[model samples]
Target: MLAPTVGAEAAEAVAGEEAWSVHMQNTNVLQGHTKIRSPYYGTNSLSQAPQMRQTVSLDLLLGLRLWSGAEAHLDGMMWEGFGMSNALGMAGFPNGEAFRKGTASPNENISRAFIRQSIGFGSEMEDSPSSSLFLKGRQHVSRLTFTLGRFGAKDIFDSNAYANDARTQFMNWSLMANGAWDYPADSLGFTTGGAAELYLHDWVLRYGFFQVPTVSNGISLDPHIWKAWAQVVELERKHKIGSHPGAVRFLVYANRANMGSFQQTLNNPLRPADITDSRNYRIKYGICLNADQEIATGVGIFTRLGWSDGRSEPWSFTDVDSSASFGISAKGTAWDRPNDTLAIACIVNSISKVHAAFLRQGGTGILVGDGRLSYGAEKIIETYYDFAVRGWLHVAFDYQFAVNPAYNRDRGPVHIFGARLHWEF
Candidate 1:
């Protein structure tokens, strides 16, 4: 049941929500990395040779007001490209836009189709921010919102103003998100689910339930309805530090799916380390903290901390048990380039002891397997500069340096360079 609009008769109420809205965006990313040290290679290993890749994506978003406090949105998306080394090899992958299942030929999909019902609880109203997924209108300061349909879990949880969007911010898997949470998603990152959000002034609480891929990191979602699913809850607080704004979010998520265990795989003598052989319905959970603060005018800093019980195999997201990241985002106003942005971030990713041992015995997850694990933490540093070319066009340059690439100490640090072009209005 939908919550009735409480202040529909007022000018600043929900009735004034947008009648219709349309937005479009396109992006092209090209990246390359030079050869790196590789004593050996496994079924899933970063290549030892120089490599480059390009990816392109187009998105069309439409929104319509359905009733006093309800709206619907649809996303038409097309993507074509491949990640370097087929999107494997690194736990903290450098390119956020790259998907594991890449295609040279263009493909289309209905990435998002959802309906949202908002319940206002206060008379105080404020203008909503611009977004591809949300309709613009005056909204209650304290309200409850319910959304149902196909979308990305990130759309409602673990958000940071400075480090969340790959198109406009730091472009690394772990930098853009808490790698260890492994929130529900299919191969392309979208999932079918429902979420509820309760906003009260500077604080909010959110929860979501989503479907996971039937097979680890596979594109197809589970067919058995709620049998294979994931759930997440988050609490967020917003406040002013000095005169600048800041926010912190704490998230916890659990997944129950047909998954394998690292320790079990290693214990099975017949099959030295085939995790899939021991698949069973199991529950896995994790917690993540995300924070961002605007320290000064046009200058903001962000950080994320994450951990998960690593006994079970990674079901969808990359295999990471412990993760931490810190970064700075600054506008170029000091240099008089008001529309330019410069950002840098660093990420550290690691697996549990049992996970390391499993890999040591030649087991593999979604990414990062060297056949024989050297058991070193994967570390990465990334920087990018983006400048506006026109009203709806922008271009960026990016670079990344990684040590112990793919958790193998035998491999030397690697350097990757990239460029991106984006258009949206």
Candidate 2:
């Protein structure tokens, strides 16, 4: 609930047609796991014992219309708690809310402070509805939009309506974004960057450049922007399939950072070949294809396929060099509950031969590091049901089954269960 002062400020913004607006939301998620089989464990391995974990987050969004076609926004966030196994082991982590830097107590920070400018090119206009960060207004259909400041790479790329937001949709990290893109970010999953988008009729083009962490999966970003940076470009098309709407996006990304090569790490016999020990300003590249379609009145299907250069170690994302994920979501209108949702998805993740060899030699990456390697592609199946308790509250039950977790055949076929509660106003 909003305090009286905040409520009054919101009312004034609406009533006076003021340029400034404020919105806030909170989400608390509780996820638990049932024990599975595991003969041994490593430093980054998931525990075979049953465990439960919870995370809580709060976000306050403030937006100000600086001038015609320009806006400034800020996001203040507070996060707390950890994920199962401290968010390690799996190439596709189970909980999207779990951050590598999670703490038992709450931590506050400014997640985003940015400026957006839109330059219209065509006379055609469209309505832009109000959301968590965008203000309600109308804008030209053909325009060039630029955003600058601190934010998340996922905030502007690889978006799927049926399977994007973890707070309201799928909970798995692989389902939330293309795992092989390795988009740049710190431990908390955000970075300082800039993005530009060109909108045309039925098509859009996007490009972004962002900062990378100082080290692989590290918490601090590199200060020397010229020495380390990540770039991404995407082309998106909107189409109709038999009177149903659909969209497809093709994306490519490159990162130039102080990173190590998989083969180089393995070939160095003088020392225990570790990726982290041999950092140099090298480049890594990847591509992703994402698509979504509405097949029926209340059903939608989405898929993502991604691949990265197998030679280099994963810098900012997971350990997967190749990935494919597909899912379907349906509304519960048939059961007289229009606001409820049901979804299921399957994901397959694999590393390169060199990466497998490195792991076989007991080399560790960001997430997976079994003592020894029994290489196999990691596969997962996930399902969830979300029930809307009221206008502003929702509850969800989720389950996941994994085969060859962390790409190790010796480990498990594991089962995981979760529950989530979310509220926004």
Candidate 3:
């Protein structure tokens, strides 16, 4: 009778532990900025002179363990405010937190809702702690993960530890993501997708398919997944240098949609030829290489190189045909403040010869076009320092300088300054 009672108590404890697997997270970010010393005003330039703009966003992330090796997650978000010139004028825009469409009033949207299942194939086990969208538990090191539902392709592809998150890291669009990959997304940067990942001891492979927006950079996504879709694959390898850790990833993506051809637009003799008039089932593809390495106790380095076929209009992401960026980040442990961080990076963005001619002929892209073109590579340098106020709160100061804004040499050497406040729990 005593042995049976002890067994029953152990079973009850295990059940209670399983029931506590549900978790919730909340994050809020407030960012404000002003661009100073603007360049010559072109018809399509971002607003000249010093103008102040601000944006605020809040996210509620929730996760629940549904069954063995399965979990469900959801995110509710509220966003408001505007970027400089309503997020226009620059290909490598300065504020990553600001949406392209800014509203005077706050708006709510469902950013992510998804289900994930993991299947183990080997006996190796690992402890996975609760972080971001994942729930806390023990997981198999060699396993297969399947995810389905609405999310950003960037959530699973082109990931970099030092340069991924905009709220806490770099503020430029090109620095946050590979500018030339052109991964599919709506105006708000979310889409319905499904992904599968295979994890092994030293490497992982991931593949994803996602829906594209109905129109070019439109807010509404196309429901016809078969007609308009994007696919991506990534291979990642983890290694150690001495006693430090590092990772490298190679990603390639292809997008098929009703997009216009740049050369076709230029050939049309119609007065003020438009790229949109030639829309058809066209394809765009790109590749990216990303790496991150921990050099010292709290110092790390990251870099990315990307390229895309420049014939098609940029369906999503930015307007660059080629890009390269590298940066270094270090924690404040040297000063006995372990939570603080400082980082600096530089990105050079360029377009193809045909792409340059399109802009020179008064054609506009999704993010760029200055009516006329004095073409030069868009070069940008950005840096930021983040100071942690508490375990969940951080304040950061950021700065960026861009030459040849929007690939137009006649336009700008713009200077931007910003501040960000972020809280997560």
Clashing pairs in 3: none
* Local distance difference test values of all predictions, in order: 0.85, 0.85, 0.80
lDDT of 2 by residue, 230-288 (tens): 99999999999998899999999999999998888877884445787677999999999
lDDT of 3: 0.80
Score every model by TM-score: 0.95, 0.95, 0.92
User: Candidate 1: misplaced stretches above 4 Å?
Assistant: 1-17, 270-272
Query: After best superposition, candidate 2 residue 243: deviation in angstroms?
Result: 3.3
State in Å the error of residue 377, model 2.
Answer: 0.8
How do the residues 1-425 of candidate 3 rate in per-residue lDDT, one tens digit apiece?
00000001111114233322322333233433345344444444677666678877776666777888998877777788887777777888888877866789998888888999999988988876555576667889999999999877888888787888787788788988898889888888888999999999889999999999888888788888888999999999999999889999999999998888989988987635578988998789989999999999789999999999999888877789999999999999999989999999999999999999888888877778767788999999999999999866788988888898899877767778888887666
Candidate 2: C-alpha RMSD after superposition: 3.4
TM-score-sorted candidate list, best first: 2, 1, 3
- Candidate 2 residue-wise lDDT at 42: 79
Q: Per-residue lDDT of 281-367 in model 1, one digit per residue for the tens?
A: 888999999999999999999999999999999887787899999999999999998889999988999989999999888888888
Error of 1 at 224 (Å): 3.0
TM-score, cand. 1: 0.95
Q: Least accurate stretch of 10 residues (summed lDDT) in model 2?
A: 1-10
